[model samples]
Every structure is written in C-alpha cells, then in structure tokens.
Target: MRGYAIRKAMQPHRLTLKVWAVAGSFFGSLCFVLFQGGKLALMLFVIVSILSIYLLLGKWSGIRKTAGSRQLMNAEHETTIEAGSSLNVSMHLQIPGIWPIPYVFVKERLFHKNNTEYTYEVTLVPDWKRRGIFEYKTHPLRRGFYTFGKTECVTEDIFGLFEHTGYIELPQQVAVLPQIVPIREWHQFHQMMKGTNHHSTTTRAVRETTQINGVREYIYGDRLSRIHWNATAKTGTWKSKEFERESLPKTFVVLDRHSQGYTEDEQFELAVSVCASLFHYGASRSFALGLVSGGAASQFFEPKHGQQHLKAVTQHLIGVEADGTYPLRRILKEYVQNVAPGSFVTVISPEHGESMLAVLHWLKQLQLNPCHIFVSADPQRKEHWLKSLKSAGFVGYAVSSLAELPVMLGGRS
Candidate 1:
C-alpha cells in the first residue's frame, strides 16, 4: 500500500517529451522528404535533430534530478482535529539549492469511514530551499473516522514540458466526534419521585449499621429482609430502614441500546445529546452520575462524581453508537439492580415501545424512582404512549426537538 501510494505521487506530468518529440520528428522527417531535399528541408532537419537531442538528454536529466531527490523529500501533517477544525502540514525537501519549480502541485486525499472522499489541492512556490509549511483547515460534512492518505507532490521540469510526481508516504487519521447539544435537566425528574430527599446507605457509613434513623411503612418493593421484626411485632405493621440523604446523591442515566430502538440517525443522535447533557449537568451539580447501556458492546460506568468522571463520560459518549442488540428495558433492568436502590433513575430512549412500559412497571414495583424521556417523539406516533404513562402517574416528557429539551428542563428547575 505504501509503495503504491508513493508511486502514484511520483507520476510525471500528463504531457511527456516522448509524445511531443515523436510527433515533431515524424512531421519534420515527412516534410523533408516531401520537399525533395531543399534548404528548408535541411533547416527543418537540423531544428528537429536539435530539438530531439535536447528533449532526450536535457529533459531526461531534469526528470532524473527530481526522481532522485524525491527520496529525500518528506511530508508530514498533524492529523487529528474536531469535525469543523483546521490542520497544520509541513513538507521538507533536502536536495540542496533553492530549485525553482514554476508550479509544484501538492494534493491530499481524505477519506471518511463512510467511503466518502474529499480532495484538497494547493500550489507551492517553486523557490524553496528546505521546508514549506501549510495550514489546511476544513469543515467536515459528517462525523466518523477520517483517514489522511499519502500526500502527492507533482514537480515538473523547468520548461513545464513534463511533470515528475512523487508520493510521500504520509498516513494519518482524524476522528470527528458526534455533535453534542445541551439537554439541560429532565423536567421535574427529582420532584416527581415519592421522596424529595436523595438518600443512600453511605450517608451514615460511619454510623452503626443497627442504628436505623426511623421506620417507614414498608412499601411492596422494600426488601422483605429489611422488615424490622421487632417493630413489626410491636406495632403489628410492616416497617423498613430509611437512611438520611447522602452528601452526594447518585443518578443513573441509562441510554437505550435496544437493537430495534433508535433506528434513525437523527433521532439517535438527539438521544445521545440528551444523555451527554444530563451527564454534563450531573458533573456541574456535583452529583455522582453513572451511565448504563447494553448490547454486544455494552458500556457500564459506575456512579462517580468530579471532573475526571465527567471527562470519562464525555469520552465514552463521543464514541457511543446505538448498535446494541439488547432492548432498553433489559439493559436498564440489569443495570439498575446493581446500582443503589431508592436512588434516581433516568432513561433516555427515542423508542416508546412495550419494553419501556414493562421496565417502568417493574421500577415502580421495586420502589425505584424512574424518569422516562422520549427523544424526538412525534405527537402523532407517541401520543397514546405518553397519555398512558401520564395516566399511570409517571410524568414523562416528550421532546419533539432539541430546542425544546432545554426549555422543558429549565421549566422543571
């Protein structure tokens, strides 16, 4: 591959001396014979002979000089940049003296992972002694991995009669991450939960395990094991431990990875932006945030807080793709079980399928606070689904567009 690219870059001008020389010689020879040996024929013969000799020797030497020096010419470039960013490039030629190339062509081929291509070309000053610096910037049309293949340098003879091109084996890459937008906070996510205070066992990790702050009437989902036998026997009523709110509460943002979900690029991207924004807000609020998604390439990040944690989540979100084979409900159900119960749960999905409905029902049964966000949900298609969720007392938000996400989120605050 390297050799092929280099060879292509080193190709000469489209027009060659041999072709023009041959035509000139042929016409000269034919005219000489047709003229029947006159002075004009002699003059034509002399001119043709001189032209042929110069073409053969002079042009050959020029080609050789370029071809030989090409080995010493190196091209390099900085490859990575954001989707709409710039690149810096440099090329060095170590052939001694400032050789004048009236027109030196440098072209680069950029290929996206989607098999689409972008070609960039530029002309350099012929008077270069050692190095040339070029700044190349472009706005990529789409997001994905981009490859910068070999740089092709086309150096032609002084007369511009022929071109000698040499390819520089410079292979680089640039990754354009997906465009992320602010999602703010899920409207009324925390307020809708039964309890306004976010509590966890760690709040009093230093306190005695036997020290139960108080007993709350046991809900159906409360751990059967948590039933305080002493209290139950004394009061003739089921009771459970209720810990105080922790210093830092945790929220699990589960991105739906169901294979059948988010089939559309636009909808999926919007969903991703929502997740990313929620993570951003979590970091700002100093809330320990965790990410959960399931598929063949499932990614699970335990609830964490701080700048480093935020960076980790952002990096993961940048590369996350909705190609999971599992359903959102399955992914959420599995992930939620591992996280601390009685904590906050947020599900972001573009699909409003039965799987989500089942997950919601299960979450309520477990007494886990649940918030479902519909990404780019169409009113006509998801109106019934939204109505049903509301009727069940589960307040859900259906964001028809990205612009509405912030408005709805801010309103809830």
Candidate 2:
C-alpha cells in the first residue's frame, strides 16, 4: 500500500524570510530617525528594501504544480532469467504542474524474506515532456522470487527550504531461471530405446509392409516375392506389393495430468525439464517429435523436425498449464486421426492404471511402439511404477528425484 503526503504551497520558512526583511527595514528606519538630516532618504531606502523582499517572496511562491500527480506507471513480471542475470525495471511516473522542480529522485526498495529493504536511488532529469521514466537494471544475487517494494520520489521546493516525499506503489516480481544442466550421454534413454526396439521387433513381421497402402500392377523389375496373388487372381492381372522405405519414425510425446501426482510447482518444473531434454534428444536423432498437453482445450503440436520445431515444442512446454482432472485419453482420441500408424510415441506422467492404459490404447490404434516415463516425487515408488509400465506395453523409467534428470537424459545435449 502506498500513501502520498503532499505539502502543497506549505512554506514552513516563509515567516523566517519575512521576519529577516522586517527587522532590516525597522533598523534602517530607526537609524534614519537618529541621523535626522538623511531620515527621509533612509526611510525611502527601507521602503524600497521591503518592496524588494515582497517581490522576492512572490517570485519564490510562484511555483505552481509543474508536474501532474506522481503515480506508478507500470510494472512487469517475468519468469525466466539467468541465475545471475539482471531484472530490468522501467518505471513510469506522472508528475503534474508548471513548477520547475530542478530534479526528481527515485528510490527503489527491494524487499527480502527477512523483511529487510535494499534501497537504490536514481535522479531523474526533468524534460519538457513532464513525464519521467526511471529505468534500472539490477542483478538478483540470489535465486527465487523477489518483490520490488514501493518507490519513493522526493522533490524540493524552488527555494530549497523544504523537501517533499511521495510514495508510489509500484510492486513488481521476477523469477530467476535455474542454470541449465545438459544431459551428457543418452545412456539411460538408450536403455529405454532398446526396450522399445525389442518390443517393436516382435510385432514387425506380423504386419505386411506396403507402399501407398495398396496393390499395383507389377513392373518388369518387380520381385516375384512381392506378387499379391489374391489381388492378381481376382483382377486377372499381375499385381505386386510395394513397400515404403524405412524412414525415420515420428514420435509424439503426451504428458499426463493427475491432481495428486505431485505438488503443482514440482509438476511445472519437471514438465519443462523433461520436454526440453526430450526435444533436444529427438532433434539430434532426426526424429519428428510432437507434444500434446492433456486438458479440455486439447493443445497439440503436430510432429515436426529441425531446430525451429524443437524450439516451438520447448516454448509450448514452458507455457504449459496444468489441469489435473483432464484425462490423457481425451487428448489421444483427438489426435488419433492425425497420428500415423507404426510411428513411435512416448508418454510421460506420474499416473498409473487408467492413465497409463490410455497411452497404450492410443499406441495400439496407431500401431505405434510407446515408452512411458513415470515421474514421481516419491523415491520408493519409482521402480515399482516403472515395472508396472513394462507390463502395460511401455518401458517405463521413473524420475524419483529432480536432480537425477540430467544424468537420466545422459549429460550435455
């Protein structure tokens, strides 16, 4: 809360200046009376001196409100910053009046957890524009959120006889991002990848491969092994099967939401960390990766590749809002038509049973091999949950602790 105390035209020293001038005049008048010959001349001089003082006082009092009422202009809050990076604050102040205030002083109060205030002052020079912008950029030495307290502006009277302090309630907040620790080698991810490969291998030969998903007239170079005998016999023409080249797989990552899965803040950080790491991994491996958040609106990013795509995915993850009640199945169902068959998909969540089963069902429909990474705040439940994922056609890896993420993704990407 901010309070403003305006001492408008309240001159505490007006009497002092007036008293000094009166005393001078009285003494001069008395001296002229004693001198006799020059009495009238000295009296005239005293009268002139009194008029000069009155004019001086009028000149001093002439300062009207030079600027408008001073108030906080705007405040900005940001979530991400380097650990030691600066939080730049640009304050807008409205001062009224034509009074020529020589200078305006702005004091920024930064409040700490201990209830201590760190003050920094800057002098704003007056411009013809009347409005002043005081800008300051200071590095946050410590991590966590810091609140910018009220700002005080002090201005002095034209005669410098008194000082006025006005407070502006410009509260601001900023969060410093933790330093990024990259994953070194993707060994753990490689292990999970191996499991997916193993699961996919068994089902590979069960489905017949075809190009353009249909039979075509056999060409001269067509291999005898590819002849679609049933189709050829029905049409009375030689038809051969054509299979698509073994292209890179498209991977869609679905993040699960559950109210009691973890604390709200923890889920947010974990989601960002995992998304960034996975996007980096997929980009390096030339896999088309998509990200979907489970919620009412069903936010989805279609599978894409390259640096721009990775950035887009990571940005979405950073901005992802958690709504724990939304079912993971709902999002998968919305994208079912868009998801290609046989594409490798991965789902991450702390949820088990229904949530895990939803991902498996989506995979079944797409004919995709899927991996599940269950993130739990509880350490003891990690392995048990991972094992449960394996039973559900997903090779699950659990994140028991937050710090283990860098190692889990294998080192720097």
Candidate 3:
C-alpha cells in the first residue's frame, strides 16, 4: 500500500534527477576552470556544487515527507444543498513547520460517478495567522453524491531549479439532493385527510402486520425468531423474517419522452430525480418500488423494496438517457405490458395529449390510476399540464425544480 501510495504521489510530476546532476557538474567544472586550475580551488568548487545539489534534494524530500504525514482536520464533511443551489466546501490544512514561501499551488482531486474527474486549483498566500481556509463553490450541475480525495500542493524552490510538491490524503464528500421531490408524505396526507377526509389509496390488499416486509438472508446481528426455517433449508443459509408492508405504497414511475422536448441533460436529470423521490418515499413506507423509462435506452426494474434495490436503481438512474428517436407510444406500450399488475404507475414528463392518452390507456389496462407528475421547465406550461391532467381523471402536480420534490414528499399541503 505504501509503495502504491508513493508511486501515485510522485506520478503527477515529471521528475528527472539527471537535470540536477548535469547542473551540479556544469557549476563544478566552471568553478574549476575559472580558479586558475589550482587544486585547492577546484576541490572547493566541487564541494560547493555537491552541497547545492544536496540542499535541493533535501528540500524536495522534506516536502514529500510533510505531505505524506499531513492530516486533514475533517475526515468527512457533508453539506446538503438543493440541486442547482451553490454549495461551498471549506477545508483546513496544517503542517508541522511553515516554509517561509509565499506562493504555493493547492489543488483538490474530485471523482464523479459519471466516470469524470474534476481538479480544483487555488493559490495559497502566506498568512501570519498560520491557518487559512480554502473554500470551493460549485453550482451542482447534477444531483447525487460526489467525492474528493488525494489533494496535492505544488511549489518550486526560490531558485526555480527544483520543485517540491505535497499531498494531503483527506477524504471529502458532498451530496447534492434532487432539485425537486414530488409528493411528500405530509402533502399526501393532507391531500387525503384534508377537509372532507378521504382515505389514502395506497393501502395494501392484505390486512397483514405492517412490520413484516419479506424473508431475506440473515446477517450476523439478526434475531433468531426472525429466521425462516423453510427458506433457510431451501437457500442453504439463514433467512430472516422480512417485513412486507413496512415500505411506503408501491409506486411504478414511468417517463414519457415522445413530446417532452428536453435537451439530453434535462431529460436525464428529470428521470434521475423522479426515481430518487420514489425510492425515498418507498423506503419511508417500506413499500416496493419500480421504475420504467421511455426512449431508445428503455429500462424496467420489477417492484421490490429494500435498501439494496434502492442503491441498485439509483446507480442506473444517474446514467439513464433518452435517445429521443423512437415514438413515445412504443415505450408506453412496452411499459404497459411489462409493469406489474395493480402497482401504482406514475408517468413523469412535460408532454401531454397523445402521449398522455396512450399512457392513460396502458395504466387503465393494468387497473392502475397511474398519476402524472409533470416537471415543466416553464412555469406557465407546467400549470397548463396540471389542469389538463386534472380534467382527464388523473391527479397532477407541477414541479418547477428538483428542490421542490422533498417538499412534496414531506406531505406539505
């Protein structure tokens, strides 16, 4: 591990000892020739040249050691911002000794899940206070989690003949929440219980205990009574009692792309946010959830509940894209045929008219209401779509941004 660390730490710079060796030799030879070819003068010149090379090597080595030993004050710092909101991350770096150097380049290494890397650079100015904070702000272009690790600081010696760099091995993490969340539990409660008091339609077909989800592989800490003997013998492992109705009401969210008219990024982001909100809501109610997306890169996950499925779906959702070349009807028909019967289907899109009508028929065939949640880039157009859905026997809500999603999920009236 240490060897790997050293190589990675050194790989950034194009290091060559040959340059310094040549410089040392050149200075030594010049001094000898200029000093009347005297033996004592030549010896002195050689000694001085050697000392200069040694000093430069020592400085570089010291910087390397300092960097390897340095520690970041915070192991992990979390700052939550609604998607598109600006977020600032501050970090403090401390070293045992201060070099009286004025100019040093500090950089942070970022790793994104989209297989992309980001490097952030800052110039460090000497402060008499000995401690300084570096603040970085980004208008989180995408939601989900982003991580930063292995920071490097580069500085050259005053002579510019040798360069020294330091590495800060700190793990920094930041999470960008979905820009909007549709249908908060609190909002749903108000919608169901407000005024005349209508019951939630999400109730289960079976009146079983809400605590049981389903049988799952047992872990070390699980209780023995939770074990399922029949499943254990069949699977050759301990199977624990799982809850069935512990999750929120089951939701099957579908994306309609035929006429939504979105840029690649906008469509992808909307799909990701919709999936995340459903996962979050399902986890809260212990409800099984599934996702389906239209377009060329079609996807579908069968209705299931658990932390693992949530993570699995989330990873796929981040990269979901719409080819936008195929007819929306094809995707809708596919969703209708593949969706589990009786699961609540929610279609998300800005498109209406034919696409909505097609989705409606599909949902009706499955005997599901299939709520429509339209995320409109334009506020007026979103309102128009909401009214249109209401007239068509489907409840609709408009989300202008991803941030409003959590408000909707939290059950805001």
Best by TM-score: 1
Model 3 per-residue lDDT tens digits across residues 1-413: 99999887875453556465656676767767696688877777777676566545536443453332222232224444456665555666544355545456778777765657877788765456434556776545466566777878766655565666778776756555654454335344223222212244432223336476567556455556668899999989888776553223346777665543565566557756776776766665566677776666677777786888876776655545555566655666666665545456777776666667676776777666566767667777777776777677676666766676666555451
**Candidates sorted by TM-score, best first:** 1, 3, 2
Candidates 1 and 2 compared by lDDT, better number: 1
lDDT of 2 by residue, 180-221 (tens): 445535554444445444665442222334544456556454
Candidate 3 similarity to native, TM-score: 0.59
- TM-scores for all candidates: the values are 0.65, 0.51, 0.59
lDDT of each: 0.63, 0.60, 0.61
Query: Model 1: per-residue lDDT, tens digit, 1-413?
Result: 99998777655433444566667776767677577788777777777676555444533333223311111112223333433344444444332234444565778777876577888887765444434444454543444566777677676655556555566665666655545555534447544332435244322233224545566566454556667788888999887664433444467888886657765777777777678778776665446788886767888898987889887776676666678886666676577766556667788887665767788878877777777888765677667767877887775777766666777676641
Looking at candidate 2, the ten consecutive residues that score lowest on lDDT are 67-76
Tell how far residue 250 is off in model 2, in angstroms.
Answer: 0.6
Global Cα RMSD, each model: 12.8, 14.0, 11.8
**RMSD of model 3, in Å?**
11.8
Query: Could you tell me the lDDT of residue 199 within candidate 3?
Result: 46
Assess candidate 1 and give its TM-score to the true structure.
0.65
Which residue pairs show backbone clashes in model 1? 9-165, 9-166, 10-165, 10-166, 10-167, 12-163, 13-163
Query: Residue 111 CA error for candidate 1 (Å)?
Result: 3.9
Ranking by lDDT: 1, 3, 2
lDDT of 1: 0.63
**Better by lDDT, candidate 3 or 1:** 1
